[model samples]
Each structure stands twice: as structure tokens, then as C-alpha cells.
Target chain A: MQKIEAVIQPSKLDAVKDALLEVGIEGMTILEARGHGRQKGHTEFYRGREYTVDLLPKIKLEMVVPDELVEKAVQAIVSSARTGKIGDGKIFLSKIDEAIRIRNDERGASAL
Target chain B: MQKIEAVIQPSKLDAVKDALLEVGIEGMTILEARGHGRQKGHTEFYRGREYTVDLLPKIKLEMVVPDELVEKAVQAIVSSARTGKIGDGKIFLSKIDEAIRIRNDERGASAL
Candidate 1:
């Protein structure tokens, strides 16, 4: 199985979640995160001493699916999370080695 | 330190939270994630065909700190999240280029 992770704008969370659901993707994980890309961090003045903020607020979404569905899932997220802006965020794909259900003690794919 | 993320069992979340709090790591974000790895998912009986599920439920945690605090933070997570089990999940560390606070428009490290 593959894991699809996206760091996006908080306001875009609902739309992305809905888009995934529309594609028959039921389960997903979302978290509030902070990061920066080409836009870098922004400048701020606090008590007159200019301070730099390197971490920007972002929403992290994680989902797992069979290997065959990886590409489709990525596209689903890209289209759903896109805002045509610079701080739109990024998506990552990774390999999962195993999975288990803590509640029922189920293992492998069945645990999903 | 850095961005310390862990994909761990749901049952272990509270314990981890308490541990981090003990160390003065106050702010964090958590999400419900799913994945399958070495265990490869499991078999289940649905109607007649034994369908296999590959995704497993997990909690994703993200945090940011100064580069100097990386090791201490990683240790905090390792000790807090350890259960001596096979499906304990994984942790990843990466470099972040910048950060910004949308509310006040702060940038760089101060955003953390």
C-alpha cells in the first residue's frame, strides 16, 4: 500500500476532504501543520525588532490505498487542494511496510 | 530541533501526549492516518468473497522546534511511543525552509 500526504491551507481542508469522498475514498487523516516553500517565511515587527517566521500554518492530510490507486489518489488531491496560489502546499507519496489494528488486533490489509 | 512526526497506534496517543507535555513541548497537531507495511494488511469475509484490506489506522503527529533540539525531541517521542510491538509505526525528519503565522503575519522562527 501507499501513503498520500498533503500539506495544504486550512481553508482548503473541507473541499479536499469532500473531493476525496466523491471519489469513493472514505478514510483519511488531517492535522494542522507549519511549513514554507519558495515563498519562504514572512517578515514581522514585534516591539520594533523585525522577527522572521520560518514555519507557516498548514493542514496535513494522510491517506493509504493499494499501490494500484496511488496515481489516481494523488490527482484527486491535487485538483481538490489547488487554489492557483503560491502557498497552496505540497503532496508526498511514501511506502508503508505494515499495518495493524490496535483495537481488534487485526493485521495486514484486513486491518484497514 | 526539527519536524518530528510519528505514525503510531491510536491507543498510545494519550501516553505520548503526557510525555511531551512533561518535556515542555506544548503545541502539536495530530491526525488519523492509515497505512500497511510489512504486515501487508489482512483477509476479511464480506458476504462470500474474502476481501483483503491493506490500510491500517494510525495517528500522525507533527511538531516544530529549533534545530538544536532535534535529538531531545526524537528521544521524547521514542520513549513516549514505544510499546515493544511490531506495528509501532515510524518517524521521519526533514528540513524546513521557512515559516509564517497567518494571524499576525509573523515569519521565520518566531512563527513557531
Candidate 2:
């Protein structure tokens, strides 16, 4: 299985979620994260004071899928999460050794 | 400076939250992360599709702590997140070069 993680603009979450759900991928985890890319955060004005804000708010989505579906999932996320703007975020794919469902104690590809 | 991440049972979240709050660590990001172990993702029936789902639902908690408090945080998480069950999840500690808070631009220890 592959663990697909995407760090994206928080605002893009709903669209991404809908896209995934439409693909019959109903399960995913979302987190409010702070990170940066080549832009390395940015400057913002608050109360007339310019501050070098370095940690941009991001939403991270993690999904575990069979090796065959990895590309489909990644493409769904990339297309949904894209904003044609800076801080669109990035996606990462990692290998997973196993997966299990705690509710019923199921394991292997079945537990997912 | 430890990024303590716990892949745990979703039900354990409330208990873990109380524990962390008790320790004065209120900031954290929770992601629904799917993973497996020696147990792996298991099988289930959804309308008898009997199709294999390779992703198991897991909760992932990430926190940035001071070097001095790494042990304390880890211990708190380990104790709070433990279920003594097979899919209780795991914890990982990784080095972070820098962190920033976009709202205020606080960096490093302060941002965490």
C-alpha cells in the first residue's frame, strides 16, 4: 500500500474532499498544519504593521490505498487541491508496511 | 525539539486531548492517517463487495516540543494513546529545522 499525503491550502480542502469522495474514496484524514514551500511563507500586514509571517496555514490530507490506486489518488488530490497560486501545497507518497481496522481487528488489504 | 506523532485508535483521541491539555500543550494537529503493522489492513464486508480495502483508518497527532520536554511529551502520548490492543498505533520523533506561525511569524521554539 502507499500512504499519500498532501499539504494544501486550507481553503482547498472542501473541493478536494468532494473530489475524493466522488471517486468513491470516502475515508481520509485532515489536519490543520503550518508549513512553507519555495515561497517560504510570506509577509502580511496586520494592524498596519508588516510582519514576516513564515508559517503558512496548510491542510494536510492522508490516505492509504492499494499500490494500484496510488496514481489515481494522487491525481485526484493534485487536481482538486490546485489553486493556480502560490502555496498550493505539495503531495508525498510513502510505503506502508501494513494497515488494520481497530473497530473489528481486521488486517491486510481488507482492513482498509 | 521533538515532533511526536502518534498513530492511534480514533476513540483514544479524547483521552489523549485531556492529557495533553493537562500538560499545558494545547497546540496540535490531528490527521486521520491510515497505517498497518504486523497485523496489516484486514478484511470486512460492505454489501458483500468483499473487495479489499488496503487503508485502515488511524489518527495521527503531531506536536512540536522543546528538546527538554521531548521525553515528557512522548511519555504522555504513549500513556494516553495506549489501548493495549493490536492496532494501538506508533509514535515517531523527527528533527525539524524550523517552524513558523503565520499569524504572528513566531519561529522556532516560540512558533511551536
Candidate 3:
């Protein structure tokens, strides 16, 4: 399975969540984070607020899906999370060696 | 070194934390999250409330540990976080190409 971690604007969270759910991706985790990208140390825009600092508040959505669902998931995130703005955030993809459902000890895809 | 991301029940946070600290593994990023497991859309148990929505509260513990501490850290988390019930979460391990601490530009393990 592949792990998809997308750091996106907090304002776009609702839209992105709905989009992911619509794509048949039911399981996901959300996190509140602060960071900067290429536009580091510049004024950052978020939820109608502006901050002239190196780091800006970001919402991170994380999930693990079967290999085949990676592209669909990424597209869903990009389309919903995008604002055509620099602080729209980035999506990271990585390999998950194993995933175990803590409750039942199920592993791999089923676990995801 | 490996980046360990564990999404577990919020109630287990304290125990998991102490376990890692006891093992000399400190410095972890904690995020408030909402997610669902195999059951997908259903009732969720969080901090003392009923979540009848599609998602449930989860605590995501993330940290990068030196290769030598990976096993010890994982064990500490697993032992403390498992509840033997459905809401218990999963652990993901991934390769981290590089880690840079911005303050002094410390790289690799130092960054972690």
C-alpha cells in the first residue's frame, strides 16, 4: 500500500474531505501543522488571514490506500485542495512496508 | 533511520508517550486527527463522546528515530497503544531520505 500525506490549506479542508469521501476513500487522518514551502519567509495567506512569518498554519491529511488507488487519491486531493496559490501545500507519497490494524491484527491492504 | 507514524486511539496517548520516553526516545510531533478503520462510516469512541459520523478522533504520533532505536520505539508504542479493540490504530514505517534542522542546518539524524 502507499501512504499519501498532503499538507494543504486549512480553509480547503472541508472541500478536500468531501472530495476524498466521494472518491470511495473513506479512511483518512487529519492534522494541524505549521510550515513553509518555496515561498518561505514571505507573507502567507490562510483562511482570510495573513502572517509575515517563516511558517504558516497548514492542515495535513494522511491516509494509506492500495497501490492502484494512489493516483485517484492524489487527483482528488489536488483538485479539491488547490487554490492556484503558492501556499496550497504539497502531497507526499511513500512506501509503507506494512500496516497492521491495531484492533484485529489484520495486515497489509486489508489493514488499510 | 526510519520515520514512524502511528495513528492510535487518543486515550492511549499518555501511555504510549511514557513508553517512548522510557526508551530514551523523545521528540515526537503529536497531531489531533479524525479517521475511521475497517468499519468505515460508523460510530466512534473518542475522549468520552459518541461520534456517529464518518470519522473518529485519533492521535497521530510522528517521529524520526535513528535506525538502532526503531525496533525499541515500535515495541514501546505497540505495547502501550494497543487496546485489543476496534479503535486501536495502525503503525507505518517509511524511508526518510534526509532530515534537516533549520536552526543550524543540522542534517540527517541530527535534524531528527
Residue range B1-112, candidate 3, lDDT tens digits:
7888899888899999999999988889998887755565567766678885556888889999898998788788888988786677888877888998888999988777
- Across residues B66-106, which tens digit of lDDT does each residue of candidate 2 receive? 77876666567667876666556655455667889999988
Q: Give the runs in model 3 whose Cα sits over 4 Å from its true position.
A: A35-48, A51-54, B21-27, B36-41, B53-55, B66-72, B97-112
Best by lDDT: 3
Give the per-residue lDDT of model 1 (tens digit) for A1-112. 6678888877777787767766657556556666655644555333455434556667787776667777877787889889796667788887654444433344445544
lDDT of each: 0.66, 0.67, 0.83
Best by DockQ: 3
Off by over 4 Å in 1: A40-53, B1-112
Count of clashes, each model: 30, 16, 0
Candidate 2 local Cα displacement, residue A29, angstroms = 1.1
- Candidate 3 clashing pairs, residues 3+ apart or interchain: none
Residue B12 lDDT in candidate 1: 80
lDDT of 1 by residue, B31-53 (tens): 77554334334553323544333
